[model samples]
Target: MKDIFTCDLRTNSKLPLGGKTIVFGGDFRQILPVIPNGSRQEIVNASLCSSYIWSNCKVLTLTKNMRLSVLASNIQETTTFAKWILDIEGKVGSLNDRETTIDIPDDILIVDSTDPIGLLIEFVYPSIVENAKNPIYFQERAILAPKNEVVQEINERLLKLFPGAQQEYLSSDSLSQADFVHDNIDETLYSPDILNGLRPSGMPIHKLVLKVGVPVMLLRNIDQKSGLCNGTRLRVIALGKRVRKAEIISGSNIGNRTFIPRMSLTPSDKRIPFIFQRRQFPLAVCFAMTINKSQGQSLSKVGLFFRQPVFTHGQLYVALSRVKSKDGLKILIFDKDGKLTNKTSNVVFKEVFGNL
Candidate 1:
């Protein structure tokens, strides 16, 4: 599909629609794209890019969030409306007292995201696979990390994960190899295809995952009740088009990213995109609570694995929000298990997150 196939959104005014089908998404409040020479103006949004063109596209607004409960979702939708017109700063992720004082359960999945591209694929490729039955063909619908080394690792891992998976490893400079082309890492000027994309060395795994439409899992911080330490899985979404210095965590690097596979959210590679956005860890366990990744989609079947539930409010709310009704929720903890009496110690954290 010729995505940027010059529809000539160039109109009477830039925002004046040139026969457009711009299914625009993403928040203008978040990260901005990193253009060469790094001008703040370069990060400007399409909302501002050519309001004229956008002003003309056939309008269709999905004000309703499918994931949140009728009440929470409605409240949020109303808030979005208020924010849309009033420009309220109501979107606050500022840390609170609960964040610092809260103590969560141990055994949180701890991961170190070193391989940027592989981590991106761990999250992105799955969703892409879900939507694009054969991704190699939909070359225009994807983004590639700049680092060739990271890209190489990703290709190897993808093949390892799905032997016949169709994908193209690309780079800017003319080369037919799968390795880091640091010299051409900033080659975003060219369009992405199965064959062309570049990335920098030591890219941040988080950004890479987000760029490729995958969520990220960072051990936000350790909250422990006993002798164990735990991590948080916060799936983030960039508020803008693209940026530089991406951070990613490759699951193929098992020795690096630490995950308690039995307690993490591991959506199959083919089922990720429908998740909207989530903390795409290399591996996820059967019954752990997931993140806001469920924001835009709906699920018929979901399994929730939770126990002492000592984590951030986001973790709790996100986990609870995964299922549509009480029947879709399942608990995977053993309160009667020995040495776990204190495991329930993370109740406050769980309660706050659960209520949200």
Candidate 2:
């Protein structure tokens, strides 16, 4: 009764004029709007899923895949249709312009959203500096997930094996307020100087980058021109504010420490909606987001998603190809007959394929 009757409907017909995303989903051939079964001739429609609407996208076809035998055709139809929907992204090249890429030296940092961030410390600066390829190096490895609980567990286990390893994290309340950038959520970062001697939040995340003691960038989450909607692919980019003092949402008349030195400002533009006026932070350069962050993004390498629930090979291909070339790409998951091919372990295969 929910998805069929009382679900939130987002369509060109249902939305207010000038809405950014027209998320229209329905098999017009079978379902009718409002008056059910009272249709004359139904249509198969997703007209709004057009190149003019979205940014970076790739066309993919999961149907007629010879990877499956004739026996699975009937059951596979729905999955294929879903894949078709995911693959029909029109004119997505413009979307790639959103992500602001920060080119920090590789040795300076290695970012991981998974558990056991301490494992990174062990992997890079071992007690005796050995090659990373040794199997003994991976003996304490565990799957990396974004949840704090999971990461804490991995860190705890790793501590027992490697007593010297230190777990690192940025426990900032301001930057970590929202749990997701998904769905229809409007988000903005404000750096107001309302309180004397007060600083905007995002200190922890700032410290995360500062501890590295290297030049870095910051990225914004919202795309002003494109407009942000639920799952509308919003991202913020930053260049040198990674470890700077940011007084975001200030109550006083002061800007973040990064405001003057890092982000060169004309004073007025630094107010709200920094996109309007001409302002550029020297220590920072930011773009929106690319196809890579949809699944998620990493600093250097990534395990591309190409499994069943993830559409077709095209999405995986785009995700994998986001790097300079194949050198930074690795297949993390794959599907065989809609099941994961590598189930025993989720160790992301690292490869410097000399492509990206």
Candidate 3:
């Protein structure tokens, strides 16, 4: 970016960002750059504060909780919730021996429930079957989990309750022809079943089941100008053989109806030995979403499902801050011993904020 700016603006290379004013915004307390199978030091080193630009950058902090201010009705309650969120973000709670676990307050914790997942779904989406057709109900609420597998479980459970005929869409997967020809790879090695089983991040899975009126999130940025970007949630209106018609439920373009077509997508993960392509609709069931993917999204009601402890920085905080108020948020922490506990792991990479 600096090289292109310096050449285009006719500025010296030594100048910071080509002597142009560039404002970078985001919280270092949130999740840092994701490095696959990376160590703690490696993940922190990949952050923006560790870059050369940090030496020339002036850090600016925005202390106001704008989301709370806009959505919260009670000023005092909003202020209290904002403070609590900051404490969670800074990891100020009583920690366990590993300094990773923190005790969740009783108000937000879902306790005395034998079926925690069922309770969580009920809390987030009350009367889901009746409200399944209402786009506003889905737009205002969601269940968040730390891992994709857990999210899928919650989504599938919620889908079973949703009232509609289920339609399953299978992706057409194959190894990239160019990669196969260039590398002289054996075609017999990767069968269709093997290709179908691979679930790459940010891409729809091989078998996608959907029902009319169920909410689905976009995996790719199909049309940004139309507000059909990645992470944008839409309600399926009409299912077709070649295309799907959905109504945008979230984002600035709410209620805007659009048609989504099946597009060929390739996995960007370099760890894969050969290039793989999958042709399918870039959508996933959004009854639940991973905490990492829930960033930048605000909801009136949010259910935090903890099948496993958070493994990354700011994940717990990110999930907690999504709701409008404490009353709107519900958390379920599952223990292996079949005992109810409010304690959960809160992973925070403090080194990323050292320079800032």
Candidate 4:
């Protein structure tokens, strides 16, 4: 910003930001900006509030969570759960020690489940096929998993439950056009199988199996105004060579049918030194979605499946708060060790919110 101001004064003899007013609003408790291969100081230095202009900024806060007031019934349970979520999120639990594990409320926990995914599907989507046509029905429920692999497993299992003929779509994976500029770039490095393996977690896989009436999520933001943004949920209506038709099942644009065309996708993984692109439909089965993807969505019924304990701050809180009412949530916490106890892990980096 200082450089930009200096450049403006040097060339145009005018300061664009000299008298301009700026306003910023956000919750510091939610996920912070993720900087890959960055140090703690580097990440903290990258935040907006860390700028020199922050001293001139005024902080105004909205205390109320509108989610609690919108619940239809079970106000008491919702209030209790909301506080519990806040307590865990703010590290105000009885065991508030930073290194100690937090105890989850017993009522919200599910145990003795050999088949957690199956139980979660049946619990969240009972009579899903019969009520598939109704967009509202799909909007009210979801399965939130901690990892992409778990989400994939749950989605594949749930896809089989949908009553329709399954259609498979394969992506055309090849070396990126940019790589052709390099004379020494090896073609074997861009093998389709290897490229598929290199795709990032949130991206659609090389092979996507879809059935009509099954719910799918947009992996990329195609049309935000039409409710076809990333994480937007839709039900498959028709499959085509170049475009697929689906009805928006969630958000303000519900019941609207939209055509999805095959688009070129590039994974934003820094681990892969070479750039690769895949041309395929930007949709993934949404029977289950990662907890990160479930952040902005509000479902009446939510199944929290934990194959592994949440390893970050506010993850447990985010998953539990997705539902409007406490009764709409059911959690299956795995006993990964032989402890056989329900425990919620909260990873709070006190330094992130320290200066705020």
Question: Which candidate achieves the best TM-score against the true structure?
Answer: 3
lDDT at position 92, candidate 1 = 36
Ranking by TM-score: 3, 4, 1, 2
On a 0 to 100 scale, what is the lDDT of residue 86 in model 4? 79
lDDT to native, each model: 0.29, 0.27, 0.86, 0.76
Given candidate 1, what's the lDDT at residue 61?
41
Give a tens-digit lDDT track for model 2, residues 311-344. 1112333333223222233333323664433331
lDDT string, candidate 4, 73-100, tens digits: 7767667777777777664334443334
Order the candidates by lDDT, highest first. 3, 4, 1, 2
TM-score per model over all chains: 0.25, 0.25, 0.93, 0.88
Q: In terms of TM-score, how similar is model 3 to the real structure?
A: 0.93
**lDDT, candidate 1, 1-356, per-residue tens:** 33332446345333223445456664332222323343333334322333434434444445543443433435654454333321211123433323333222232211223543343343334444454223232211121222234233443454344423232221222321232243444334332342222222111122232223222333322223321122222222222222211122222221122222212232223421221112222211101112332332233233332323423223333333333433333322324442222122111111111111
Please name the candidate that would achieve the greatest lDDT relative to the true structure: 3
lDDT of 3 at 255: 95
Question: Model 3 off-target regions past 4 Å?
Answer: 1-14, 91-99
By the TM-score metric, which is better: model 1 or model 4?
Answer: 4
Over 4 Å off, model 1: 1-12, 16-297, 306-316, 331-356
